[model samples]
Target: MTHILAKYLVDARYEDLPANVRKEGVRTLMNWVGVAVGGSREDPVKRSIAALRPFSGPPQASLLGRTERFDIMNAAFINGVSSHIFDYDDTHLKTIIHPAGPVASAILAFSEYHPVSGKDFLNALVLGVETECRIGNAVYPNHYDVGWHITGTCGVFGSAAAIGKLLGLSEQRMVWALGLAASQPVGLRESFGSMNKSFNPGRAATNGIFAALLAAQDYTSSDGMIEAKRGWANTISTKQDYREITEGLGQRYESLLNTYKPFACGIVIHPAIDAAIQLRNQYHLTPDMIARVDLRVHPLVIELTGKKTPQIGLEGKFSIYHSVAVALIDGAAGEKQYSDQAVRDPRTVALREKVTATIDPAIQPQQVDMTITLKDGRKLHKFIEHAIGSQEVPMTDQQLETKFEGLTDGILSQAATRVLMDRCWQVESLPSAAAIAQAAVPQG
Candidate 1:
């Protein structure tokens, strides 16, 4: 399995990618930059930079949305951390892995150290996402059920494959890179709702770059590190499907299936939030008008986001109670809705207590059954088949642009944001991929 995957990654070329897949690659890049730049000033990102600055080597890459530059490895780590701070990065729904944080963060940072064409960058981006998601597919659910954060664990493979591609590694060297990546898996499900959650992807990016660099120097490792009896799959998961990794290498692109979040929370809670927003807008409902809110959703919704009361913004992102409350009160669930102030707002808290969720085995993760009973004895019901951001109902390009603008509003001037967005869309035509990073930084 390892040999086949390495050979495929080595042979894959930009000219072979389908147009839609290439387009999604740009979309992935665009969304990732928006979130990274928007989150650059968050406490976690600031703290990370401050802690790493003294130890960092020569500045070789720009940290998106901030003026400070760091060495490629440090830049990749911080950018990966920034992109996921809001939990708004692109998610491959199948594995719930935020693909770009690990792949894009590494390659974009490396692009500065070694100039790469826009086409090559996008190709690396697509292939990286494909690599991780497929590996994730091989050991999902069971791997995830065991408390391993699949993104951080599987994401290293993505980072290795992407940076290794950019480094022009031969098949043998690429196999060694994969073997090295197999030895390092960061992140735990317990880290969710805390600063550590963001740390996972950041560390994955750094680890991947480390693995690829060592391989470039002809570092050695067990060739079957991923498929041996005690390898990553067998050791980390109860089930392994090697076919998912080796089958349909170039033909099936997981990158195309990536989805951006309309709401900045766990993907499982999206349906409830979408229902709340729609019902709120439809009836002009206010806190006083709502009597009791009831929800019947997949068991995972409660298992993942059952926080009855969230004290901080990050915790709020993991609470369905808070998500529904804010969506009803604000008619939207952007970054502000998850802030500490918003989470603790009397109005939000008061309404959040009124929201109750019941697990229903029949309800799919993306579906929601909701009931809103008004103070006046009026009852409203909404059943969402698929949330707005689900692949079934994707956010439009205009909506993506709007989301980008919202995230970058005060961080980057309107002019700079527009230029950055244009650069993302036209990334394929650009001579150098570094222009996107340059546009992401704030201008005086």
Candidate 2:
């Protein structure tokens, strides 16, 4: 009668998550808040918040973008969407799961309605992140290759489990919640460049909450939904090591492995970002000096981030060529690097056209190698063993703070941003979850 999934959920809520996990969980939340606020001005986020204004629920949670009495579900939907609008949210490359948006959005919605403590909110986040990374690891080559956005699709179950833990669901009930979540998974890579990209995480937060609520009401789905023959495995997996999901569930903290995004682009291009940054700094290279740029990268990155003619910010965010060009010209890659101006810059666009990538099958998705040939016929080679913000080289507290402040500077003033960052750092000791949520998404 022991359900490993339920045990992990309950234990994570009450005990298993350590101090570091809680601290990191809140940090992830803080970074997510930054992206959501920054995305407030994004056309995609604006359009959806505007669209949902007329479909208000109960004024449960504050939509970060606008001043409206949005329901908890709508609040989650909008917040989740905005978080990924710029593709700046944190990533767990090992699982290929976009962790922050879905988990933070779901927790924000829950916090508005319930008066749970920040420590408990952190617990739910840790649990949710675990579920997210686990599923992503299990699917591996097969599920993601089939064109499913794992962050949005599998993220629902993680969001549901986290919400369930926060609501204090029983062990059996948490299992039911997972089943309910499994039945409604949705997301497609085909929708990458459109508004639907944000839609995936939005639905994940809303539906995940619904699944948990329904399960608490004794809603039942197939008992073995996760590992069942015709369950997630059969429906979503291929060439996947299903065993990876359960192997380190209780022993290791998966959220710790999550990578923070420095550039508002696909994680696959992160190595390219590192390499570009290296080249930019080493030579203090100017765009005019670079005659032609060539990138030797993993085949997976080539497939995912090889957009050659990006016309918009979102499209540029997914394009390696554009990102590399901007980093080289600007000397730094920031949220602005993905702005319309940056994306549509004639200089950047022209430089991007000169940059070409060749596939290297040996270089895995988690890594990238670059060999840049400058106009002077000088070759600059940079091997980014790991992206800067990844677990291999995690962002220090000071760095994460700088990222939060820099990203939220104009949006959230110094005083407000400091308060939010401080609260997240010691979330385990906060008064209540509502305090954390309010500090994050203030009414403007």
Candidate 3:
């Protein structure tokens, strides 16, 4: 049977890919690198890397943003963790799958052990993203509504497929890889407010890479793992819409639909940030001028971004109140806004107390919207038909580069930053994957 996944992974043709698809792939790579760099400074990622010191494996791979090296799996784990440390990684808004976390993390780590050209990097990344987004779209509202982390659940399959392509797996063997990946799909939304959140993708990166390696050796599994009644698609997911995956196949690329992020918080908070930023500029209001801020949103937003009095950095990302306050006060929402000190600031806490969300049952049926009322007798309201990065207004190349530089600034010297950016832009061109692995390591 030609399943949706098989149609894309096995039968899809790459002849008609649009030009911008390739450019977007590069943009996502840039964004992911920036996220990984920014995330390296996170306390959880630091602790995780520091904890790995006892393993003492050969330094065969590079962990982006850190000089520490480990086996490919460990390296992928650390890099993947760092990418989402701040929840700043790129996203495919439609699926809510953070594509770069699993795809870029696994591919970069695998490249460290296996050399492939920059063109190949682009191709492999493009394919991985297509696989991920398509699967995400297929089972989306149902899968997510039923409670599953798509990035961690579908991510391993996509990451494994990408790596298998680089390893030149036969179509049959690729199917085996997909089956192996399906058996390992894992991630949970319950961990969103804590470090368990980032750990999902990192673990998927490790599992995905390992799966591909095993499949390349002619490892075997049931070919129908994705569609079997008791298989991955139905067991762990709510429903299987196979056409979404098989419809385009290779005739169209899924990567083009990927969205880049402009902020470093949960995707649900973006609409509120946009609304708040607008109010900040139009009202010319400083933090002192604001009396109260009220917002309306979908229940998911409240569930995900509803941390009322977040006490820590990670918690701040999930706090709609804190995120809105940061956008209005700081005029920007970046890693610094989520710093430990930022959360404890009295002013931010006070602002959080004033902000409250209305669970409008009407809008809950279709989308998320937010309205803010200010003390100066001005009311600013916006119906966020779509969030900023929902494949609606993607971050431009210049914007992405600016973000990358900012994240890697002190961590990587100007010259090194330039080198890494160039390497990522032309990743598939490298004669040795070792070049990227070595380049990603932080300098002492």
Candidate 4:
């Protein structure tokens, strides 16, 4: 399985990808850039930049939304953190891995160091996403159930595969890189809610770059570290399906499964939020309609995001009650809806208290059953079979542009944001992939 993946990573070409797959890569890149820049001024990002600035080796790569640059690896780490700070980055729903942060962050940072063309960059992005997601598929329920953050645990491989491809690592060196990455899995579910949640993906990005660089120098690691009896699979998960990693390498692209978040919070709550907003808008129901919202959701929704009253923005992300309340009242669930102020708002709190969720084994993770009971004795219900951002109902290009605008509105000048958006959409044609990162910086 390792050898097969290495060959695919090393030999895959941009032209080999189907047009839609190539386009999906662009979508992932666009969404990643928006989230990274949007979260650049976040507390976690600010503190990380402040702490690392003095010791940063060299300004070799640009930070996505800020003017500061750092050595390639450090830049990868910071950008990865920023991309995931809002919990709004793209996700491979099968394993719930945020596909771009570790892979794209490392590759784009490496692009600055190596001058990679846009076509090559896109190819690397697709391969990297595929690598992590496939590995994620193999160990998902077990690995995730055991409290490992699947993105950080699996993302290092994506990062290493991407950077290794760019560095032209041989099959043997690529195997070594994967082995090294395997030895450095990151993030625990217990860390969710703190800045460390975002740190996992960022550190995975840096770890991958570290592994690849060392492998390029002929640093040795056990080649079977991923699937060996005592290797990552057996050590980290009780069940292993090697076919998930080895099957349909070039034919099936996991990057195609990538889903972007329309709401800025956790994906598990998206279905309920979608249903709530739809009901609010459809009936022109205001929060004052004197209603209680009832939700029947998948068991994981309550397990992962059942917070009844979230005191902070990060905690708000884990609160399905808060998500539905804000969605119903504001008709949106963007970052503002999950803000510290929003979480503490009296109106939000009142509505949130009226919202209740119960686990329904019949409901799918992407589906929700919502009932809004009003003072007028009118009961309106919506059963969302699939959330808007799910693969079944993806956001349109126009919708994605709207999201990007919202994220950048107050941060980047209109002209700068427009330029950055254009660069991201047409990234495959650029002479250098770094242009997108350069354009993302806020203009004074």
Candidate 5:
């Protein structure tokens, strides 16, 4: 299985990608850059830089949204952390893996160290996302249910495959890279709602680069590390569907399945938040007008975001109660809605207390049944079959631009943000892929 995947990655070319898949790759890059720049000044990023800057080697690549540069590996790690800090990166709905954080983060950083064409970058990005998401599909609920953060664990393969492609590794070397990546899986579900949660993707990006670099040097490992009896699949999961990894190598593109988050929280809570925001906008409702906000959601929503009272912004992101409350009170759930100040606001707190959720097995994770009780003895019911950001209902390009603008509002000048957005859209045409990173940093 590992050998077959490596060969596929080695032989895949930009010209083979379908038009829609390539377009989605561009969109993924755009969303990732927006979030990374927006989250550059976040506390976790700041602390990470402060802690690692001293140990970092000579600067080889730019860190998105900041002036400082670091070694390619460190740049990948930091940018990966920034992209995912707000829980706002793109997601593969089936695996719940934020594909770009681990894959794009590594390859973009590597682009700085070694100049690659935009086409090559995009191709690598697609392959990387495909590699991880397929592996993720293979071990999903079992790997995830066992407390492994699937993104961090599966993401390393993405990083390795992407970097390996750029490095022009032989099929054997690519297999070795995968083997090395298998030895290092970072992240646990226990780290959710904390700074450490962001650390997973960061480390995955770094580890993949490390694996690929070593493999390029002929670093050796068991070739069947991914599918052996005691390998990653069997060791980490009870069920291993190797077919998911090799069945449709070039024919199926998982990158096209990528979905961006409209709200800055876990994907499972999106339906409820979408329902709340729609009802709030439709009725022009205020906290005083809302008697109670009731949600009948998928079991995963409460299992993942059941926090009744979230003390901080990150914690609030994992709370369906808080997400719905803010969506109803503010009519939107942007970064501001999930901020420390927002979570602690008296009005938000009071409204969140009135929000309650019940799990329904029949309700799909992307569907929600909501009822809003009013102070005037009126009840408003909304049943969301699919959330706005789901694959069934994707965010429009204009909506994505609006989301980009909102995230970068204070962090970057309108001019700079626009330039970055343009570069991201024009990535495939750019002479050097590093131009995106250069555009991401604020000018003096």
Candidate 6:
């Protein structure tokens, strides 16, 4: 199984990708850059920079959106954290794995170290996304149900594969790199509301770089570490279908199924936010006009995002009620909507309290049935069969560009932000991947 994967990775050419697949890779990169830059100045990112600066090695790579540079590995870690700080990165809807943080973060840093061309960088990215999402498909709900953050758990494999490909590791060493990655999954659901939640992907990216670098120097690990008895699959999950990883090597790309978050919160809360925002716009509703708001959603919605009253911004990401309240109150659910100020706002708090949710097993995870009752006894309803950012209804390129602009508006000058965004879109034609990284850093 390991050798099969390595051979495919070794031989998969950029020309082999479908046009849409290649385009999606650029889209993924563009989105990752935006979120990383947007979250660059967050409190968690600031603390991480302070904590790691004392131990950082030689400055070899850029930290997207910031002026500081660090060793490639530390740069990868910091960039990964920044990209995911808002919880607004790309997701493989099937497994809810945020794919880019670990994979892109690692390779962009590696590109700085190795001088990878944009073509090769893009190829490695598509392959890395495929690697993690396939593995994610094999163990999805089971692995996730057991308290693992699927992104950080499976992302190490993606990171290792992408970096290993860039390092030109032979099949034997690629196996070792993956073996090292398998032994180092880095997240738990218990960390969701804390800074540790973002740490998982960052650590995964750093670990993958470490794994690939070691393997490039002839490091050896169990070749069958992923499938061996008591190995990753058997130990971490009760269900393992190897076909998910090996059945469709290059023909069917799972990276194409990647979805970006329009809202800066958990996927489970998107439906409610979508419905609420639509209702708010339709009726121009205010908190005082709302009597009661009710939501019927999947059981997982309540399990994953049922926080009725979030005390802080991070906690707000996991709150279905808070998301809907803010979306209705503000007509948008961006990072600003989930800020500590928004969470503690008297109007938002009151609206959130008025909002109630019930688990409806029949409702799809990406769908919500929302009903709003007004003070004068008018009832409004909106059923979101497929939320805005779902695979069924994905965000468009122009919309993604808008999202990018929104993220970088205050951080970079308008002209500089546009230049950075254009570079990301044209990444495949660029002479070097380092150019994109360089453009991402704040300019004087």
Q: Is candidate 2 or candidate 3 better by TM-score?
A: 2
lDDT of 1 by residue, 1-444 (tens): 999999999999999999999999999999999999989999999999989999999999999999999999999999999999999999999999999999999999999889999999999999899999999999999999999999999999999999999999999999999999999999999999999999999999999999999999999988998999999999999989999998888998999899999988899989999999999999999989999999998999998999999999999999999999999999999899999999999999999999999999999998999999999999999999999988999999999999999999999999989999999999999899999898998888
Question: What stretches of model 4 exceed 4 Å from their correct place?
Answer: none
- lDDT at residue 293 of model 6 (Cα atoms): 97
By lDDT, who's the top model here?
1
- Compute the lDDT for candidate 6: 0.92
Sorted by lDDT (best first), the order is 1, 5, 4, 6, 2, 3
* Cα deviation of 28, candidate 1, in Å: 0.6
- Residue-by-residue lDDT tens digits, candidate 5, 161-212: 9999999999999999999999999999989999999999999999999999
Q: lDDT by residue for model 4 over 81-134, one digit each (tens)?
A: 999999999999999999999999999999988999999999989989999999
Alpha-carbon error at 42 in model 2, in Å?
1.6
Return the lDDT, model 2, position 431: 73
lDDT of 3 by residue, 119-200 (tens): 7777777888888778777788788877788899888877888888788877778888888888897788888878888998
Steric clash pairs (candidate 5): none
Q: What is the TM-score of each candidate against the true structure?
A: 0.99, 0.95, 0.94, 0.99, 0.99, 0.99
lDDT of each: 0.95, 0.80, 0.79, 0.92, 0.93, 0.92
lDDT for each residue of candidate 6 in 353-443, tens digit (9 for 90 to 100)? 9999999989999899999999999999999998999888999999999999999988888988988999899998988999988898887
RMSD of each candidate relative to the true structure: 0.6, 1.9, 2.2, 0.9, 0.8, 0.8
Predicted candidate 2 versus true structure: per-residue lDDT over 120-156, tens digit per residue: 7877888888887787777765788888888887899
Model 4: pairs clashing at backbone N, Cα or C within 3 Å? none
Candidate 3 residue-wise lDDT at 359 = 81
Q: Decide which is better by lDDT, 5 or 6.
A: 5
Candidate 4 lowest-lDDT run of ten: 1-10
